[model samples]
Target: MTTRFDPRKALLALSAPVLAILVAVIVTSLILVVAGDPVGEVWSTILSVPRPRVVVSIINASIVYYISAVAVAIGFRMNLFNIGVDGQYRIAAFAAAVVAGEGWLPGPLNILLGLLVAMLAGGIWAGIAGLLKVYRGVSEVISTIMLNAIATILVAFLLRKVAFRTEGSNIISTTPLPEDSRVPGMAIIPDVSREVYGLLFLAVVVGFFYWFILGKTRFGFDLRATGRSETAAVASGVKVKRMVLMSMVLSGVVAGLVGMPLLFGQDHAYGSTFQPGLGFAGIAIALLGRNHPIGIIFAALLWGFLEQQSNALQITAGVSDRLVLIIQGVIVLSVVIAYEVIRRANVRFEQRKVAQALEEQESMTKEGAPA
Candidate 1:
């Protein structure tokens, strides 16, 4: 069955996030004023045009964020919350770093090998939770959380005991990938010394696949069906357990790519200093984006922009960089509240329309029948 496009519905859907953002801005401004900060200066600093370097940084950061959000969104679509994305990506990255550091294969092949290993590591790590949920009836939330802690400990052990350290570096890290295996950054932003990530195209591809897989395919239909109602899905011949496992694994596979941009284009190795907490951040982005691929892109860009501007806020407006955190927290909360309010409003409108239609039908029936 084809669903016709409804512009009003689309507008209504978009309103929640927009309203939430405006509320966040207002709240943040009030907070600044109350804290004796220069609210106007803070606003100006955040809203001003960024330098080319900062733009590049924001774009790069958004790429990573977009990928992470996509990973989280996959599980969200399946009614699964794979919170261990942090661990999945970290383990996968360490595995990739270990492989790339070896340079056993020729240039391009080495890069491909590392990527494959990363996906495998991530899938296997997340699959454990899937297995537990399917066979042992363990809550994925609990299992994944436990897995995250274990993954951290395991990675730490492997880094110290198994992975070779880069020579002369104080930071404990895997051997850096060979020059040939490293992806060179693209000079997409002219006049900016900072180059965009070489793997920017990868994010595009991931987004396209995410949209297609979830919106187009039979598997996608079954996944959504199961998400909506497991009992009904089972009655319709969907394999709920298998879907759960596959969805979790797929999410982890994408999660594995979350670190690749940094690993290949910038960091070139997994290290103690590798960025953490992106998995948690991705959850917020996914929520903000409403699990839609296009919405996720905007949400990620907004998140990255705010993060990039936080430094400027601290330096120029003399506000603490932590102000951004408060703003972000408020935005997330506001989105939740806004969406709930909009949902209730929609329900009421629909109910009223149905009642009016029923009343008109009754009046017309009486006039035609007894008169």
Candidate 2:
């Protein structure tokens, strides 16, 4: 069935993010003024055209961020806050590292096997929280928070005690994967020393699948229904509990890929230097993107650009790199407030339309009756 589009509704939908961004800019500028910093210089530094290498770095970073955000967005869509995405990706990357380090299979097969192991590890870790929520009536937020700590400790222990230590290195790390197993980097940009991660394609594929599953399939419909109202979904014959479990697992499966771009394309091993907190960052990006696949890509790129600018801000503008963090926080808060305001406005508009329709119906009936 073709759905009729409302231009006014579309305009309202577009306005929220734009309003949020404008508010963030104003707030950030005010903070800069209060701090006695050169607001214009900071803004100029942030908006300055980056070098080719920096551009490549931004793209590579955005790829990882996009994948991570997509993972979080999946859980968000189901109204499930999978806070343990950070932990899931960490543990999964560690497992993938160990498997790839083994080099038990031939080149391509070994890489594929490691990827599969990562997905399984992530799914299992996230499934624990899902199980508790479904069967034990536990709050997923609390359970996942605890799971994050547990996963951190577990990964540390495994790294310290079980992982093969690289000789003469100060940092502890799993055995590095064989050269053949490492994914090749793509020279997508000219005159750039750094190459884009080959796994950029993976992010594209994940986005495509996320959009297709959530927008075009029966399972997606049921999942969304369950998210909106479990009782209503149950009345509609959707198995809410099963959807809960599946959604969490599916979210984690994507989470497992959070580190692949870094792992396969650069690090080639999980180590002390492996970046943390990406899963948490994904939450912010997911919110900024409104949990839409396409929106998440732009949000991730914006995040990546800000991150890349942090260094330049420090060197050129002499501004604290932490300013980026403040900006990010402000943007998220603004977006949340804007969306809430828009939601209330939409509700009032609908109510007014309904009231008007009812009044007109009553007037028509009275006119038809004998005076």
The best candidate in terms of lDDT: 1
- Give candidate 2 misplaced runs (Cα > 4 Å): 164-168, 361-371
Tens digits of lDDT, candidate 2, 1-371:
99899999889877888898889889999999999999999999988898889899899989998988988988888999999899999999999999898899988899899989999999999999999999998988899889999999999998987566667868888999999899999998987778999988899999999999999999999889899999999999998999999999998899999999899999999988999999998999998888988888888998999899888887877889999999889989999999899999999999999999999999999999997
Prediction 1 TM-score vs. true: 0.95
lDDT of each: 0.93, 0.91
Candidate 1, number of clashes: 0
* Alpha-carbon shift of residue 327 in model 2 (angstroms): 0.4
lDDT of 1 at 238: 100
Model 2, residue 264: distance off in Å is 0.6
Tens digits of per-residue lDDT, candidate 1, 107-194, equal 8899889989989999999999999999999988999999999999999998987655556867888888999999999998899888
RMSD after CA superposition, every candidate = 1.6, 1.7
